[model samples]
Target: MYIPQLSNQKAFDSFILIDGVLHFFQFTIGSKHAINRGLVGVGEKYGFPKDMAKWHFTFVMPPNRVLKVPQAHQGPLKDSKLYSAILDVGVEIPVE
Candidate 1:
């Protein structure tokens, strides 16, 4: 998805699922309104929604693999820059 794939982006970051579950992800920014919003979810922790029209979500899918996103990670994808971030479960934060 890209900015042009929508009627308009006036209020918040708008995005569409290009690949529900695939090896790659993508998104296109539409209106600035949406881009400014970033990611959104039930809580404020999931990365603020971005206006990227397409966002690529990828994980190594294995046979009989039931991916369970950590409670914190369920919110938003980590910055791609942290492609190899180590997960430290010893530190826990109480959620509201």
Candidate 2:
């Protein structure tokens, strides 16, 4: 389930939550146009005492040009070469 794109429904939706149900996330709520945003962080962690399915979460944001920070691990190579290796390997990965 998604956070519904808000139009004039903010008042009613204000207290709604992702609830950590299905072990999902807690995200900052905001307007659809990216104005008047608010910070909402929940540190509650969910564990799989029995069912392991809750540990996975997949999110797909709308497409846009992305500028990303260097990854936590740069691997065993220099930036240019490593970037090329990653790109070559990633090229054939399917999106869907």
Off by over 4 Å in 2: 1-49, 65-96
Instruction: Report the lDDT of model 1 for residue 84.
Output: 12
Per-residue alpha-carbon lDDT of candidate 2 for residues 1-96, written as tens digits (9 for 90 to 100)? 435377454312222223432323222222122211111112133132223222222222223222232321332211111011011322232333
Task: Give the worst 10-residue stretch by lDDT in candidate 2.
Answer: 77-86
- What is candidate 2's CA lDDT for residue 23? 29
lDDT of each: 0.29, 0.25
State the lDDT of candidate 1 residue by residue for 1-96, as single tens digits: 324355554322233344431112222221111112243342146432353223333332223223333222323443321111123345443332
Displacement of residue 49 (Cα, Å) in model 1 is 12
Give the top-scoring candidate (TM-score).
1
What is the Å distance of residue 73 in model 1 from its true position? Answer: 9.8
